[model samples]
Target: MAQNTDGGNPFAEPGELDNPFQDPAVIQHRPSPQYATLDVYNPFETREPPSAYEPPAPAPLPPPSAPSQSSRKLSPTEPKNYGSYSSQASAAAATAELLKKQEELNRKAEELDRRERELQHAALGGKATRQNNWPPLPSFCPVQPCFFQDISMEIPQEFQKTVSTMYYLWMCSTLALLLNFLACLASFCVETNNGTGFGLSILWIILFTPCSFVCWYRPMYKAFRSDSSFNFFVFFFIFFAQDVLFVLQAIGIPGWGFSGWISALVVLRTNTAVAVIMLLVALLFTGIAVLGIVMLKRIHSLYRRTGASFQKAQQEFAAGVFSNPAVRTAAANAATGAAENAFRAP
Candidate 1:
């Protein structure tokens, strides 16, 4: 056995030192820092007694039982199930929640319905329903079909029938004029006279119908409706001129109507039947001219009662023509073009 030079482990045997894989129980325990078990040093004081560290009191022992039962772990806040039969308290709470939701939905539905009805009323433009008390319009119009709605606003209640009668007479006049055109055509074919009169008469009828309605009837309607001095004067001026033209057409002057004076003379020279027909046609034209004069006079008298004058008509005409947006725009463009052309000139 060899002695160690440095202080050696007293418990370690010479054979054990050679064999480190040997069981450690054979070696004596040493108080070295590398292999020490450290105790925690807490600065704070604890309420637990020294006995508490002596090992927890053996967990309360279960009571002796003949048979064992299974136990379930439960959370403190977990809700208990009522199985098939729900508790009355829970049922009442759920019903209250459902009722609140249903009431909210009902209120919303009522608000939506009210808004829908208001929208419908506004969209209909105040006239919510039809008022069909008045008599219906005639089935057919001889000259041109007139929309009752167009004139209904303008015409007075008492004078509505008078206006209707005037329209009927106008239709008759249109028919008479058409007949005169046909007569002129027949006379030209028979006598071989120049067709200038026939052509002019056709032109006159074609131009006059729409022009007369626009110039006379419209102004007359407006005058009566508004009791406007300007409108009445315009109606009177146009209508008087229209009546004069009618009288001239009825006269059958040299270049007027082929079927008028010339046709009458030729027919008188030839066949009695033809002459009678031509005379009747000429008489119809004369009657229409006379009717026009009478209607003009009647309307003029009514206008005079309203105190309309030529001065007011001139002012209205000037305002209507100059104040129009289209007229202003046209005038502006013309001025611009004229200026540009003058600037460009050599």
Candidate 2:
């Protein structure tokens, strides 16, 4: 072998001098130096070897996230949807107001209808032509009803309850009278000497039932219905008399006719059952007397509040008398007769 120009081992294998680690096939498969730098193992830094796969193109660089509603800020140029929420609230409020107005209109319409009906009813003969419904007589009964008693129609709203209470009290009084009659009958059966009480009880029921309806009840009703001072005075007078009668009845004067406390106690020695019945009737009468007093006071208070007076009552009476056609004619006839008599005398 020729001596080498550069210093070399002459005894070394020829392939060793030409780089024994190099192979043509291996070199063809090996990656380039730049790609090999990507595979360098460093303890402090990490790297992945690049291959023909190209690392799946770095996972497409995950898309950026949008900002949350709380984090996002609005600009003046970008209009907010606040108008939509405000309009919804305003629409709801308007709907509620409209409903309230509609309800008021409905109430007014009902009131108008009621007034129209009243006007129509009153159109005939300058008075209401409706049939009397009070006394509640049957269709087949020969006796027709006498009055038209509608508290709602005749009395003011403030007085309706008081009038209704009075009506109920009257009904209670009638029932109490009926019960007294039965009690007196029982007493009479127990003692033959009690016949006077039984007879008087029947008379009391028959006499007082219609009389009470006419005297105090009717006057009070008329007082409230027309606010008549005269009617109020009449009620006070008659009701005072009624209260006296109630006291007398409750006293139970024997033989004078009432199943009262005295009669009940007297009969207790003779018969316990009769005594008990008379006692209950006496209690009923006593209750009526007390209720009468309370009702009188209530009515007096109501009267005072109404500004009614004796002068008003006199004026009402005078107006009523003068307005009567029969009274006017009689007065005119008397005046003409007096004038003729005076002329004749002269």
- Using lDDT as the measure, the top candidate is 2
Q: Which stretches of candidate 2 lie over 4 Å from their true place?
A: 1-118
CA displacement after TM-score superposition, residue 261 of candidate 1 (Å)? 5.5
Q: Residues 165-193, candidate 2, lDDT per residue (tens digit)?
A: 88887887888889888888888888898
Q: What TM-score, over all chains together, does every model reach?
A: 0.49, 0.68
Give each model's clash number: 0, 0
Query: Model 1, range 1-346, lDDT digits (tens) per residue?
Result: 5656555555677665644444486454543433334444344846344332355568888987654222444468976554536576779789999999998888667656655654675678744333332234454734433422224434554455556656665676677778777776666666556387678769867987767767777666667656667877777788788777767666666457624555576667756665566677778778877888888777777766667777877887888889999999999999999999999999
CA deviation > 4 Å runs, candidate 1 = 1-149, 261-263, 318-323, 327-346
Give the CA lDDT, 0 to 100, for residue 259 in model 1: 44
lDDT of 1 at 147: 26
TM-score of 2: 0.68
Which candidate wins on TM-score? 2
lDDT values of the candidates? Answer: 0.66, 0.85
**Collision count of model 1:** 0
